[model samples]
Target chain A: MGNENRIVNGLLKLHIALCLLFIFAPIAGSFVFSLNSDRFPSLPLGEFSTEWYRLIWEDPLVWQGFANTVVVGLTVAVIATLLGFGGAYTDFRYNFTGKSFYLALAMLPPTIPVVIMGLAMLAFLSRVNLSGTTISVIIAHGVMCSPFAMAIIRLRLSQMDPDLEAASWNMGGNQWQTLRYVIIPFAKPAIFAALFITMAVSFDEFAVAWFVSGLNETLPVKILGFLQGQVSPRINAIGSLAFLSSMTLIILAQLLLRSPEDKKS
Target chain B: MKVNAEMEQQSEAIVKFDNVVKRFGNFTAVEKADFEIGRGEFLAIMGSSGCGKTTTLRMLAGLEDPTEGAIYLDGEKVNGKATWDRDTPMVWQSLALFPFLTVQENVEFALKMRGVGKEERRQRAEKWLEKMQITEFANRNINQLSGGQKQRVALARALVTEPKILLLDEPLSALDAHLKVRMQAVLSNLQKDLGITFVYVTHSMSEAFSMADRVVIMSRGQIEQIGTPEEIYREPYNRFVAEFLGSANIFDSVITGPSGSDGWKVDFEGGETSLSKDELPNAVQGQAVTFIVSAENMQLSAPDSGQPGILASVAGEEFIGGTAMVFLETETGHELKVQKSHDELSLLNLHAGSKVIVHWAPESCHILPGENL
Candidate 1:
C-alpha cells in the first residue's frame, strides 16, 4: 500500500510540473529572446544585449501606449472596485426578492465571449461618440473587470460574522457610519486585493480595448500593431515587461488576501 | 402608601413592550409580547432556540420592528426608531468585536460614531479598558486576545456609551463551564455597579437564574411566565415551565372531592393524594389538574420497608457536582426524579433496577395555575 501510494504521489507531482512547464515555457522563451542580440528569435547562442529594451524604451509610440495603459488600468481599478463593493454589500446586507437574479446579472459580464463583448461595446461606444479614445478603453475594461472585483470582495464578506454589522448599529452607529467603520475595515484587505486584481485584469486586457480604442491604443493593442507590421524581438521585450507588471500586481493582491494575523506570524 | 410606591415603580420602568407582535412573512417570531423592565433590573429572557426569546430582545433593541403595537424606552414611544437612534447597546453571542481594530479602538468606536472629541474618546475608552481589566492589551488586535479578554473588550465597547440599558444575547454561551461561571460573576457585578437595566437573552437555565434578578420564560413565541428565578423554580406557572425547568416530576390528576374540612382529595395515575384547600382554591370535583413535585422534595425508600409511596425501580443516576440525581420508573411507567447527596444515595444502596419507593408530602406538590380541564 505504501509503495503504491508513493508511486501515485510521484506521478501527480510529475503531472503538475509538466503542466506548469507547458504554461510558462513560451513566456520564458520570450523573456530569454528579448535579451539576445538576434533579429530573429532563433536561439543559437547570440550575445546577451539590451538593444531591444533600448529600442522599445526610446519609441514614442511605445511610450504613449504604456502611458495610456497605466492611466486606464488605475482608473479602471478604482471604478471597478467601487462598483464591486456596492454590489457585494447589497448581497451581504439585504434579502429582497430578485436578489439572486441581481447577483447573477452582476456576475454575468466576464463569462460573455470576449469577441462578442468587444463587438457590443464598440457598437455602444461608437453610437455614444465614446469610441476611439483612452476613456473608451477604460469604460470597456471597467465593464469586464468589475465582476472579478465583486467576486473577490464577496468571498471576504461571506467570512464576516453576520452579527458584526448589527452589533455596530446596536452601538449607536448609523448605516453609513457602520459601513465606514465596521464593514469597510473588516473588508479592507479584500478591497485592496480587489483593486490590484482588477488593475491587473485591465492591464492585460486586449480584445475589448482593441475594439474600442482607435488612435489611443493601449500596450496590448500597440503590441498587436507591432506583430502585424513586423516580427520583432522588441515585441518580446514589451511582452516580458507587461508580463512582469501583471505578475507583480497579482502577487501583491495575493499578499493582501492573506489574513492580517497570517502577516504577523 | 404602598400603592403610591408601586405606581412609582411602574413609571420607573426603563423599557416596555405594549402588546408587540413581530411576524416575518407567515411565521410569527414574537406573539403579543407585553412586559416591562424596571429601572436597574437585570431581566433575562430565556428559552430554547426558536422560542422567540432573542426575538423579543431584538424588538426591544430596535433591530427588528414589531408588526403590531409599540415599544417604549424611558417613557418615550420608540416604535420605528432606528437602533442607532436608541442608546441600547448589545453584547452579541459571537462577541462581534472588530477584527481589524485594536482593543482600544474597538472600545472607542461607539464614542467615535457619536462624534466625541478625539481626546475624550481615548480617555473614556481607556477608562473602560481599565475597568474591564484589559488595559494592558489595549493596543493589541482583537484576535490577539483570549476568549475571556475578548468578552471583556466586547463589554467595554458596549458600555463606553454609558447607555441606560444594556442587552446581552447569550454572551457567555461560548465559554467553558468554569469560565462561564466566572463571567457570570463579572456580568452580575457589572450590572449592579453600573445600576443600569439589563435585558439578557439566553437558553441556559444556569446562566439566566444565576445572573438575572428576574426571568421571562418563553416557549413557541409566547411568554410562559415572568418572575424571580426562585418563584419560577418553586412554583412554575404551567406544565411547560415545569418540564422546561427539567427538575420536577409532573403528574396529571383530577380533584376527587373534599378530603376533610380543610383539604381536597385528588387522584392521579400513580395514586391518590390530598391537597390543602390553600393549595387548590375553588377546586371542583372531577376537574383535571396538573401538579409538579420538585426533585429535591422527593424521597427514596427501600421498596420492602412498607412505606406509603409509589413503588418504582431505579432507572439511572446523574452526578451533579456535590449532589446526585436518582431517576426512578414506577410500575405504572411514570418517570420520577429525586435529587440527593451522594452520601444519602450511598446509604440507600441504590443501583439500576433496584426497587425503591418514591414519595413526597402533599404540601410539597404544587398545582400548575395555568392548566384548564
Candidate 2:
C-alpha cells in the first residue's frame, strides 16, 4: 500500500511539472528570444541587446496597436462587468417565469464556437449597418468576454446567503438600495474578477475582432497583419511586453479584490 | 382575563392582519391569519417546519405579500407596500451579517439608505454597537466575529433603524444550546428596553415561553391558538397544540354516564375515570372524546398498591438527570409516557416489565374533542 501511494504521488508531481513546463517554457523562450541580438534568434553565445525593444517602442504601428488594445480592453471590461453583474444578480434574486430560458440565452454565446459567434455577430451587425466599426468590435469583444464574468459572478452570488437581501429589504432598503448596498458589496470581488478576465480576454480577442472590425484594427489583428506581412524580432518584443503587462494587471487585480478575511491571513 | 385585556388593546394595534391568506402557487402558506399586534407586544408565531410561522413573519415584514386580504400597519393599509417602505426590520435565522462589511457599516446600512448624514449614521451605529456590547468589534469584518457576536451584530443592525416593529425568524436556532439561552435573555431584555414590538417566529417552546408576551400557535398554516404562554400550556385547544408543545400523554375516551351533580364517569383506554362537570361542560353519554394528561401530572403507583389506577407494564426508562421519562404500555395496547423526578422513580424501583399503575386527577387532564390519529 505504501509503495502504491508513493508511486501515485510521484506520478501526480510529474504530471504537474510537465504541465507547468508546457505553459511557461514558450513564454520564457519568447522573453529570451526577444533579447537575443541575433536577427534569426538562435543559440548559445549571443549578446543580449535592447534593439528590438527600442525598435518596437519607436514603431508608430506598434504604438497604434497598443493604444487600440487598451481602448478596446477597457471598454469591453466595463461593459461586460456591468452586464454580467446585472444578469447574475437578477438570476440569483428573482423567481419570475422564463428566467431559466433567459439565463440559458446569456450563456449561449460562450458555449457555441467563438468563430461562429463572431461570424453571426458580424452578419447581424451588418444587417443593422453596425458592422466594420470600432463600436462593433467593442461590442463583439464584450460578448466574447461576458460569459466568463457571468460565470464567476454567479458562483459568488450563489455562495452568498440569500437572507441578506431579504434582510436588507426588511430593513427598509428599496430594491435599488438593496442591490447597491447588500448585493453589490457582496459581489465586489467577483465584479473585479469579471473586469480582470474580461479585460484580458478582450485584449487577446482576435477571431471576433478580425471578422467584425472592417477599418478599426485591434492590437491582436494588427499584430497578425504584421506577422502575415513580415516576421520581425519586433513582434517578439511586443509579445513579451504584452505578457508582462497582462500578468501585472492580473496580479494587481487579485490584490485589490482580496477579501478582508483573506487579507487577515 | 388575558383575552379581555388584549381585546381592549386591539383598537390601538401597531400592526393588524385581516383575513390574510398567502399562497405560493397552489400551496397556501398562511391560511386566513387574522390577528392584531398591539403596540410594544412581544408576539411569537410558533410551529414546526412548513407550518407557515415563518411565512406569517415574512408577510408581516413585507417580504412576502398576502395573495388575499390586506395587512395594515399603524392603521394604514399596507397590502401593496414594498418591504422597504414598511419601516419593518428583521433579524434573519442565519444572522445574514454582511460578511464583507465591517460591523458598524452593517449596522449603519439602513441609516445610510435612508439618507442620514454620515456623522449621525456613524454615531447611531456606534450607540447601537455599544448597547449590543460589541463596540470593540465594530471595526472588524463580520466573518471575524463569534456566533454570539454575529447574533448581536444582527440585532444591532435591525434595531439601529429604530423601526416601530422588529421581526425575527428563529434568530437563536443556529446557536449552541447554552448560547441560545443567553441570547434569549439578551433579546428579551433588548425588546423590553426598546419598548418596540417584536414578532418573533420560532419552533422552540422554550424560546417562545421565555421571551414572548403572547404566542400564536399554528399548524398546517392555520392558527391553532393564540394566548399567553401560561394559557397555552394550561389550555391547549387541540391534540396538535398539546403534542407539539411537548411531553403529552393522550388517550381515547368515551363518556359513560349522564351528568350528575358531582361529575361524569368516562371509559378511558383501559380503565374508568370520572371527569368533573367543569372538565366536560358539553359532553354527553356515549360521546367519544379526547383527553390530555401531561407527563409530569401522571402519577405512578405499584400494582395493587391500594390506589385506583390503570395497570400497565414499564416498557422502557430514560433518565435525564433531574427527571426520568417512564414509558409504559397499557392493557389495551396504548402507550403512556410518565415523567417523574429521579428520586421518585427510584423509590418505585421502575424497570422493564415491572407492572405499574397510572392515574391523574380529573381536573389535571384537559379534555379535547376526539380526532383520529
Candidate 3:
C-alpha cells in the first residue's frame, strides 16, 4: 500500500512539474537569448551581453509605447476595480429578478474570442469616432478585465459573514457608512488583489489593442510590430522584460490573496 | 396607588410591539407579536430554530419592519425607521466583528458612524475595552482573538454607543459550554450595570433561564408564554411549553367527573388520579385536559410498596450533576421520568428492568392553562 501511494504521489508531482516547465520554458528561452550577443536566436549562444536591452532602452518609440501601456494599465485597473467592487457588493447585498442574467452579462466580455472582441471593439469605437487612440485601448481592456476583478472580489465577499453588514447597520451605521467601514475594509485584500491582477491583464493584452491602437500602440502591440519588422534579439529582450513585470504583478496579487489575517501589519 | 404605578410603568416601557406581524411571502415569521420590554429589563425571546425569535428581535432593532403594526421605541412609533436611525445595537450570532479592523476600531465604529469626534470615540471605545477586560488586545485584529475574546469584542462594539436598548441574537451560541456560562454572567452583569434594556434571542434553555428577567417562549411564529423563568418553569402555559422545557412528565387526562365537593377524578393512560379545584379549575366532565409534573417533583418506590401510583419498569438512569434522572415505562407504555439526588436513588436501588411505582403529589401537578379543555 505504501509503495502504491508513493508511485501515485510521484506521478502527480511529475505531472505538475511538466506543466510548469511547459508554461515557463519559452519565457526562459527568450530571457536567455535576450542576454546573448547574437543577432538572431540560434542555439549556440554567443557571449552574454546587454546589447539588446540597451537598444530597446534608447529607442524613443519603445519608450512611448511603454508610457502608453503604463497609463492605460493603471487607468483600466482603477476603473475596473471600482466597477467590480460595485458589482460584487450588489450581488452580496440584494436579491432581485434577473440577477443571474446581470452577472452573466457583466462577465461575458472576457469569454468572447479575443480576435472577435478586438474586431467588435474596433467597429464600435470607430462608429463613435474614438478608434485608434489610447482611450479606446483603455476602454477595450477595461471591459475584458473588470470581470476578473469582479470574480476575485465576489469570492472574497462570499466568504464574509452576511451578518456583518446588518450588524454594522444595527450599530447605527447607515448603508453608506457600513459600505465604507465594514464591507470595503473586509474586502480590502481581495480589492488590492483585483487591482493588481486587472493591471497585469491590461498590460499583457495585445490582440484587442492591436485592432484599436493605430498610432498610440501599447507595448505588446509594439512588440508585435517589431517581430513583423525584423527577427532581432531586441524582441526577446522586450518580451523578457514584459514577462517579468507581468509575473511580478501576478505574484504580488497572489501574496495579497492569501487569507486576510496573514496580510495584517 | 399600586395599580396606578403599574400603569405608569407600562407606559414608560423602553420598547413595545403592538400587533406586529411579519411575513416573508406566504410564510409568516411572526404573528401578532404584542409585548413590551420594560426599562432596564433583561428579556429573552427563546425557542427552537425557525421559531421567529430572531425575527422578533430584528423587528425590535428596526432591521425588519412589521408587516401590519407599529413598533414603538422610547414611546415613539418607529415602524418605518431604518436600523441606522434607531438607537438599538445588536451583537450578532456570528460575532460579526470587522475582521480587518483592530479591536479598538471595531468598537469605535458605531461612535464614528454617529459622527462623534475622534478623541471622544477613542475614549468611549477604550472604556468598553477596559470594561470588557480586553484592554490589552485593543490593538489586535479581530481574527487574532480567541472565541471568548471575539465575543467580548462583539459586545463592546455593540455597546460602545451606549444605546438605550441593546439586542443580542445568540451571541454566545458558538462558545463552548464553560465559555458560554462565563459570557452569560458577563452579559447579565453588564445589563445590570448599564441599566439598559436587553432583548436577547436564543435557543438554549439554560441561557434563557439563567440570565433573563422575563422569558418569552415562542413556537410556530406565535408567542406561547411570557413570564419570569420561575413562573414559566413552575406552570407552563401549554403542552408546547412543557415539551419545549423538556424537564417535565406530561400526561393527557380526561376529567371523569366530580370526585367530591371540590375534587375531580381524572383518568390518564397510566391510571386514575384526583385533583382539587385549585389544581384544575372549572373542570368539565368528559373533557380532555393536559397536566405536567416536573421531573424533580416525581416520586419513585418499589412496586410492592402498595403505593397508589402507576406501575412501571425502569428503562434507564442518567446522572446529571448531583442528581440522577430515572426513566421508566408504565404498563400502558407511557414514558415517565423522575429526578432525584444520588442518595435517594441509592436508597431506592433502582436499575434497568426493575419494577417501580412512579407517583407525584396531587398539588405538584399543574394543569396547562392553554389546553382548551
Name the regions of candidate 2 deviating beyond 4 angstroms: A253-265, B1-11, B369-373
In model 3, the runs with Cα more than 4 Å from the true position are: A1-14, B1-11, B279-281
Show model 1 residue runs off by greater than 4 Å: A261-265, B1-11
After TM-score superposition, the amount by which residue B150's alpha carbon in candidate 1 deviates from its true location, in angstroms, is 0.6
Q: lDDT tens digits, residues A1-265, model 3?
A: 9999999999999999999999999999999999999787897999999999999999999999999999999999999999999999999999999999999999999889999999999999999999999999999999999999999999999998998899889888899888988899889999999999999999999999999998999999999899899889999999999998999999999998876666467
Residues B172-240 of candidate 3: C-alpha lDDT, one tens digit per residue: 989999998898999999999999999999999999999999999999899999999999999899999
Give the higher-lDDT candidate: 2 or 3.
3
Q: Residues B1-373, candidate 1: write the lDDT tens digits.
A: 9979756756799888899898999999889899899999999999999999998888889899999988888878898999999999999999999887889999999999999999999999999999999999998987788889999999999999999899999999899999999999999999999999999999999999998999999998999999999999999999999999999999998889989888878888878887778866777899887888899999888878888888889999999999999888888888889999999899889989989888889899888898843
Model 2 agreement with the true structure over B180-260: per-residue lDDT tens digits? 999999988988999989999999998999999999999899999999999888877788888887778877788889546
Task: List per-prediction Cα lDDT, in the order shown.
Answer: 0.92, 0.86, 0.92
- Candidate 2 matches the true fold with a TM-score of 0.94
Select the stronger candidate by TM-score from 1 and 2: 1
